[model samples]
Target: MNADTRALLSEAFAIIDGIPDDAIRFGAPRSIKGPTLDDGTVCSPEGWLAQHPRFIERGLRLTEDGSAILYRGEGSASVPAALPMARALGLPLDEARRLFGQREEFTANPDNPLTDKQLWEQRVREVLGKAHSPRAEVQELAETGSLDPHFGHDVPL
Candidate 1:
């Protein structure tokens, strides 16, 4: 990923980490359950984007049915169509696609009763570590003689 993409992912991850587990109900860009938060926040990627100070001008909000994000208010789409999650989040299309897949694979299974915030965050770290681990770094050096792109090159072996 490019620096900007990496930064975006890191920002998103941080926002997610800060949110309490009860506030989260993943499976879509917006919560599958509508208006779960006391403030009517959707509590998913769409909610994250909506809550983000950077893209507040986009006026992105969850549909009443809680399916997707759509522009609301002034400059809103004439048809009020749902925005693509990537576009709403201001992420590059490809990176958003990959991130979505990562979210699915790295997050806890919705059906697993043992899942919790600690377990979910642990899983997230494990997936992230695979990309940044010393073994991955050594393997990259062995194959390409250069580091993979992104921050933190001083990983302990």
Candidate 2:
């Protein structure tokens, strides 16, 4: 079969989108296998994987499928549309601010003004519903002095 790189990218983006506050997918065994190099590295070894753009789209879709199947067909809810992608990924808060600054879509509002994360959460609630508000709250806490910056995401050892 011909490799549809674009389709693959779409799927990966879907996976990334499906997984909120995620750096990588869970439970999918990391597999890297292919050619060999001179450094005794099995060019493709255990947990070998691709993290490029095309693959990311597919990976995210794959996440949506698995999580939906296992969790009563529920999938990743729409995250806050305005929420900075960095916040959802647990990237530094500054990243969210910076990302928002760069987006042509992001605009200043005098009424119903939302901070970077608030704008994001508001977007998320519209699609995912109220249940996801906890995430938004968590995001809020992280922004304030009260919560640790690592508020929403799972910690990796």
State which candidate has the highest TM-score. 1
Cα lDDT tens digits, model 2, 70-141, are 111223423221132232233344433432232233445435444433443343344334553344444443
RMSD after CA superposition, every candidate: 11.8, 17.0
What is the Å distance of residue 150 in model 2 from its true position?
5.5
lDDT of 1 by residue, 12-56 (tens): 455455555665654444453332333334355445555454445
The superposed Cα distance between candidate 1 and the true structure at residue 126, in angstroms, equals 7.5
Give candidate 2's error at residue 79 in angstroms.
21
Candidate 2 global lDDT: 0.28
> Candidate 1, which ten residues in sequence have the lowest lDDT sum?
148-157
User: How close to the true structure is residue 73 of candidate 1, measured as C-alpha lDDT?
Assistant: 36
Predicted structure 2, TM vs. truth: 0.21
- TM-score for each prediction? 0.47, 0.21
